[model samples]
Target: MEWIILALVAGVIGYGIVIYNGLVALRNRVRNAFSQIDVQLQRRYDLIPNLVETAKGYMAHERETLEAVIAARNRAHSAAQRAAGTSGADAGALGAGAVGELASAEAALGGMLTRFFALAEAYPDLKANQNMAQLQEELASTENRIAFARQAYNDAVMTYNTRREQFPDSIVANSFNFTAAELWQLENAEARQAPRVSFGNR
Candidate 1:
């Protein structure tokens, strides 16, 4: 009877260790996924200033639109920094609130960029500028990368969350304080689409 009880105890402890390791692995996957998004978002943010500068000469009268884009870009960049910091701090440190803030800021930036592009459509010279075309193409490519990264991040979060919530895993997760992660979601439907970067017939 003593040996049987000891064996049972050892088995339970071993199972708990396995669960803990799995949670840690999932958490790290989530962090890695978010970092991928951060890289692409940084790339997109870096392109915005050059894009705005190129437009300034042609869209001189559209100062408000230009300024709005910059303001939005700044806000989004700040939010991204915060989210990245949280993910880097420690395992399970990246909370839902930080992800939500980043998503909101990104959506706002997307809206501003959409407006900037719509306004640029009126300026034939801007649309025809070789520099503008190249920047637009780059921005569009970055946007695609961001989309793919976001999907991967969300998938990782879902898997992590689900695993943590499961019965046997939940026991280990709760004991170890493995907090749930949030999915990056754009609130605006329009913002979900990448801005139209095409310079048609120009």
Candidate 2:
């Protein structure tokens, strides 16, 4: 009887250990995924200055549009930093509030970028400028990378959330104080629509 009771206790302890370790692993994966998004967003932010500068000379009439892009980029950069930092915290690890901040900021930035690109359509000389063309290409590529990174980050969050919410794992998650992660969402309707981009001719 003693041996049997000891064996049962050992089994429960071992199972608990496994669950705890799995939760830790999931949390780390979430962190790494957010970091990937931060890196891509940082790249996008760095490219914005060059893009704005290149457009300035030819877009003399659309000063507000250019300034809007810069302002939006700054806001997005700050939000991305906050998201990265909040994911580091234990209490709200990947909470909706933190990630939502980034999503909203990025959505605003996307809308501004769309407007900026639409402005490009009106400026023939700007379209013709090699620097502007190159910057546009780079920005598009960075956007693609950011999309992929966001997808990966969301996937990680989904997995972590599933593990945290499921029964057996949830028990471990609760004991360890693991919180649910938030998905990155598009908040701007304009951002959802296809951008009007006609760079060449009319």
List clash counts for every candidate, in order: 0, 0
Q: How close is candidate 2 to the true structure, as a TM-score?
A: 0.92
lDDT of 2 by residue, 45-133 (tens): 99889988988888888898888899999998988887777777876456558788888888888888888887688778788888877
**How far out, in Å, is residue 39 in model 2?**
0.7
| Candidate topping TM-score | 1
Model 2 pairs in collision: none
Candidate 2 ranges beyond 4 A from true positions: 193-202
TM-scores, one per candidate: 0.97, 0.92
Give residue 183's error in model 1 in angstroms. Answer: 0.8
The Cα local distance difference test for each model comes to 0.90, 0.81
Candidate 1: pairs in clash: none
Query: Tens digits of per-residue lDDT for model 1 on 5-76?
Result: 999999999999999989899999999999999999999999999999999999989999999999999999
Distance from true location, Cα of 25 in model 2, Å: 1.1
